[model samples]
Target: MTALERIAEWVTSNPPVTAARRAAATDAFVDTLACMVAGASDVSTLGAIAVASHADPRESAMCVDGAMRAPSSAALINGTAAHALDLDDNFIGAATHASAVLVPALLAAARQAGADGAALLDSYLVGLQVQREIGREIAAKHYTAGWHATSTIGQIGGAAAVAHLLGLDATRIVAAMSVAVSTASGLKWQFGTPVKPVHAGFAARSSVEAALFAQAGVAGRSDVLEGERGFAALYGAPHADWPTAPIDTSVAHAIEQPGLFPKLYPCCGSTHLAIDAVLDLLREHSFAAADVAEIVVTVLRPNAANLPYTHPENPTQARFSMQYALISALESGTVSMADFEPATVRERRTHPLLDRISVRTWSEKAERIMLDQGRTPHRVELTLTNGRKLDRQREVARGAVSEPFAPWEKRRKFTSLSGLSDAHYDAALRLAASPNIDAIERLLAAAIRLRNGAGE
Candidate 1:
């Protein structure tokens, strides 16, 4: 069987997802919901919501405004909002924001199909496994080649999730995957623009449409993933390997392994390890930001390539700049969403720190070693005016699987970002664990009410 066929079969089958895996999936979902609520008012998200509101209207929930829209429109708006702040969960192996794409698409499709919460969570688990596996097969070359995996590889995963929600058999699921493969398109060059969040929106919308089209008897080539001119051949590296059979998830799902890396800061994941390293050093040594004469950060070559801006002109670009992330953490002792605001990014105090910071690419040997260990490594060094150099190296960031957020910590983060009361936060956690479609609607309604009253 072809790669797409195998993937479709796996997605349609019932994989044994452990309780721990289910809990992790719930955490990812809750995190994505918090991100959506927090980014609801962002310019990019608002603009996409406006556009989607004008499109065909169907009955589905809009996480931000609590409005009902068509499935595609709902996916478009919610997906865009989820990624607007760049705080959504990411899959390091896939080099993509998995929940940002999967949550919105699956939720929309589920609402349309009247699928229960259990089905939604199960589909998400299966789709996430497929996305990361495909990423492994393509290796890091797909990302290094300038393709935005969130939309490219994510499109396939989104389709799988939607297909499962729609109860499509293996044959129809293959058609959906084929349609997704044909529609996949995104570029990494758009990283610092409003269009970056829109990429997630497009992936969610396209996947929903692909699955719906296949359910309506639309057909596509089953071998679209591994064919001669297929996704791997044209979009991935020339030497990429295509797996003949799907990786078995019956014993353990991918969500239990490397899993999802939820963001602690509202910046690019590439800058996270360096930010953590700097914060670690700051906590160990007592020194003001002004006491540091110079700072240097070293990271894997791929991360360095992702963060190209030395001095960002705006908040959007700041999210992709290692200099901004590191210096902001140093000055404030923490990096929060407020630090990435336009006014904050333009602060004169930060300019001095930015001038003192420099980002360097790690050695080829170091990069290979880190990759082999399945790690994203970073090192931070500070040269004090007294000629003392303090340094720290981190193999992984805080929210990664190696050092995941505790239950209370994640709850605090959700409340902080969503601006919801503790009661609402608890309600969300309960709903995430039990997931009925009707309960989801009520949860969103309650959140909207709280947000309006809080004037957030």
Candidate 2:
């Protein structure tokens, strides 16, 4: 059988949903919801809302703003909003914004199907596992080749999740995945633009439509993933060994293993490690930003490539700029959302300190050695005016599984970003045991109302 078929079978076969897995899924939902709230007013989300609001058959799915849209359109708008700020969690195993796509797609499907919170969490774990399985084959090459894994890999896995939620059989699950494979597309060139988050919206919409189409008897090739002209061949992995082993979700789920990297800073995750490294140095030493002669950051080639902007002209580009991210952290002792505002970016762009930061990459041989050893390290070297050099290297950022945030830390982030109360955070925590997601939807609507009232 093809790899896609094997995945479909595993997806259709109900795996045991452990307590730990459910908690992880719930945590992901909370984070994605907070992101959706924070980014609701972003220009990218507005664009998605405009499109989704105009689609036919509206009122099928609830948006963050309490407005209703068609199911696919809701998925698009919600997904875009979830990722617009670039603060959503990252699953390194898949090299994608896993929850940003999964949560929006699953939420819409769950609401439409009247699925309870347990079902949503179950489907979330299932979809994340599928993404990990597929990402194992092509993530490194695909991401390096400049294809946005969040869209390409996300759609296939998201389709599986939506199919599971809608109670599709193995055969129809295969059909959904095949349809998703054909529609999945995104590029790294859109990194500094609003279209980057739209990639998540597009993936979410495709996942919904593909699964719904499969349920409606749309036929598709079952071998689309490993076929000669298929996903692996066309999207960076030419000769990838598809399906090396059966997916076993009986043990640890992907969310509990390599785990999701939740962002503390609202910028591209590529700059996160470097930011953490520099912060570590600053905390340990007595040097101020003005005391530094130069800042040198070293990361993997792909990360280096992701940060192409040295002097960002706007907030969007600032999110992808190593110079801006690092320097802002240095200047203010930490990077905050306020730093990325248009006026702040414009003011900081002319700072002489921006030119003092230089970014480099590890040699190809060193990168190969690190890759072979399963290490992704970002190093920061600070040269002071008195010739004192402080160096720090970070393999894991603050919010990664290796160094996770405490419960209070996570709650603090949620409240700070969404401008909601502790009751809302507790509501999200209780979702796993709730009868349905209706309460969560109401909380989200309240967040939208709050934000609108605050004129944010």
Candidate 3:
């Protein structure tokens, strides 16, 4: 029995308490929905994704704005839109966008399946737990070896959601898990490319296909996870060791740990500490980008490595560039959606400030490999020419698995993300406190209608 086997049995039995998972699901749900709405107007990128997906479509579920399409296509668009701004939540342990990767896909499938909000919410919890467990089992090992954990571990989440929705028998669920092992994919090298968003879309599409295959009595290798030639052997070597026997997962870790970090910024969580650190410094002093001389950031490996191209030629690449992001923060006093525009990144003023920024490992905690990152966590030190130097450090970034979101913080985040008016905000509170998706949707629709009629 693999971890999937155990999870399948537990979820099959417990079916998960809706009330328990509801609040968390609703929190993430509201955030994902907000991102989708905000992103809907992003005609260039998000619009492209939605248009590309329009080529082939099916009506399995209705998306956030209430459009119906094929399960796979719906998931792809929703996943891409939810993550377009890079503001969705992340999972440190898994090294990926936790909610962004899972919620959109499940929401589409469940809504199309006519699943009540309770079932949809419960399935999402199951997906979150399963994906995180897979991530812990692999750790940074596979990711360091070059796999993107969000796509790699996230497919399992897709599988979990699909299984719960279909009521797959344990055996079939185990087989679907096997399909996921083979399908696990995503590359960090593609961070700045359109393929980055494709990672989320592919995971969502694969899960739907994987589940459909299993439902059709297609059998996959049950031992694919721990098998000698399986996922562990092929992709996750050097990190492949779980306590469960080849056929025993009865004592698998309980599936009820809290979910991952809900993000505030629209970039990698790796960038958060630095962003927050820079903001911290500004709290004390108001300095224009031109006023600042050199801003130095010393941090961990990819935290440093994840920084986008020094000169981001495009919006997608801007997400990966620390130089650009930090510069935008210094100039704008915040990093907003507007900062990523082509004109913004190309501005001569912003470029000079970005050029003034330099990052180095400062103190070599370890030798610099081609990417010389030390074993110890990276610490950031920003120095300004005004003879001002500010220091900030985090062993674990705030939204990392080490530090999770507080309930109130999540609500505040959700409310802000939902773009709900005062009345809608209060109404959403009621809906979130005891979720009824249909009722919530109706309330949301009525609010919009009211707002529109007011102009008349």
Q: What tens digits encode model 2's per-residue C-alpha lDDT throughout 392-451?
A: 899999999899999998999999998988988998988888888877787877887787
Best by lDDT: 2
Off by over 4 Å in 3: 15-21, 41-58, 64-66, 111-113, 245-259, 285-288, 348-350, 360-378, 396-456
Give the Å error, residue 49, model 2: 1.0
Candidate 1 residues 1-456, lDDT tens each?
A: 887887876776677877677778878888988888888888888888878776454676555678888888888888999999999998976888999999999888876777766678888887898787788878487887889999999988888889888999999988988898888899888888899999999999888998998999997999777778888889966566667765687676778777788999999999888888888888888788778898888887767778877789899899998888887887789889889877888883347777888888777787778777777678888899999999888888898887988889899988888776677666655654554666556656666777778442
lDDT of 3: 0.65
Question: How well is each residue in 105-145 modelled by candidate 3, as lDDT tens digits?
Answer: 77656754556666666677767767766676774567666
Worst 10 residues of 2 by lDDT: 52-61
Task: Supply the TM-score for candidate 3.
Answer: 0.82
Against the hidden true structure, what lDDT does model 2 obtain?
0.89
Error of 1 at 365 (Å): 4.2
Off by over 4 Å in 1: 55-57, 432-435, 450-456
RMSD of each: 1.9, 1.5, 4.6
Please list the residue runs of candidate 2 whose C-alpha ends up more than 4 Å from where it truly belongs after superposition: 454-456
- In model 1, state the lDDT of residue 73: 85
